[model samples]
Target: MLTIGTKAPLFAAESTKGRIDLQTLIGKKKLVLIFYPGDETPICTKQLCAIRDRYSDLEAADAVVIGINPADLTSHQAFSGKFGYDFPLIADEDQAIRKAYKVGKILGFLFQQRIVYVIDKQGTIVYAKKGNPPVTELLQVVNQNP
Candidate 1:
């Protein structure tokens, strides 16, 4: 996987909120690209909803949340709306973005290994960890810088 401080690979892909360009989405704020293996699974749903439930806090911290999966837009929309996900769940169907970020799963993986990357305003990664850890940790990272 790409390590912290690496230049975030740029990509413009389909998202539940519509076409989302990385650069365009990161406007004036840091971004958290949360990657899950697939959509609608138990852990994935819990993780996404956890973020959704605290989305206002994320926004207040001047940070943006975006989820990535291999699912297409149709699946993404259904998943997003079904759960009222506040952030964009991006469609990384071809796995281009996941490969760019080196976030793809191994053969035995359950779900993309559940990772999160906190990218600063300049699109530089400042924090990277596994399994979405905790929003508190993320909030601390965002509160401190990026």
Candidate 2:
């Protein structure tokens, strides 16, 4: 897990919204990177839907939300369309981003762990937590930096 104040690992990948370059987003918007195991699963769906439901709050804080999963672009597109999510869902097909963040599975599990990282405008990681962190907590963090 990446500690607070550490520089976030930069990545550029295809997403539902378009090509996303983490470096470009830095110094522009506070970012919330949602790393999950797969698309359309129960927990992952719930977690993303929660973000969808409160997306405006995230935007109000001048934050950009991006979800990363090992699923392909087609899967991510389908899932995002089904949920009407406006944010980008990145397809980490080769798991490079997952490996970069050290968000691999527990024990011998095949899926990545559910992790959330909040990065500030300067490319510094402000928060890193495993599992589904509350939307309120994330909003508070975003609002604080804005």
Candidate 3:
């Protein structure tokens, strides 16, 4: 996984909200990249929904929450539509972004491990951890950084 204090890898990919370019967002907004195993799975849904529940707080902090997985755009769209998620879910079907971030696979390469990264406006990753961390903790980091 990517470590804290490292420059975030840049990429452009299709998302539910249209094409997303990391370079364009780098200097403009803080970023929360939630890398999950699969779309609509129990743990993944719960993890993202927690962010959805408190999305306004993230927005108020000038942060954009993006979900990334190997799922295709169609799967991401269906999941986002069902959950009413406001943020973009990147269709990393090729797993290029995953590879760039050094996210590893589990279940014998069937699923990517769940990880969360908080990147500051300058595109430096400030927080990197595994599993589902509380949104409050994430807010503290984002609010504390800038």
Please, what is the TM-score per model?
0.93, 0.97, 0.99
Task: Give the Å shift of residue 146 in candidate 2.
Answer: 3.7
- Per-prediction count of colliding residue pairs? 2, 0, 0
Candidate 3 Cα misplacement greater than 4 A, ranges: none
Q: Lowest lDDT 10-mer window, candidate 1?
A: 104-113
Error of 1 at 138 (Å): 0.7
The digit string of per-residue lDDT tens for model 3 on 28-122 reads 99999999999989999998899999999999999999999999999999999999999999999889999999999999999999999999999
Ranking by lDDT: 3, 2, 1
Among all candidates shown, the one with the greatest TM-score: 3
Q: What is the C-alpha lDDT of each candidate?
A: 0.85, 0.94, 0.96
Candidate 3 to native Cα RMSD, angstroms: 0.5
Better of 1 and 3 by lDDT: 3
lDDT of 2 by residue, 1-146 (tens): 88899999999999999999998989999999999988989999999999999999999999999999889999999999999999999999899999898887864777899999999999999999999998999999998875
Question: Which rank order by TM-score, best down to worst?
Answer: 3, 2, 1
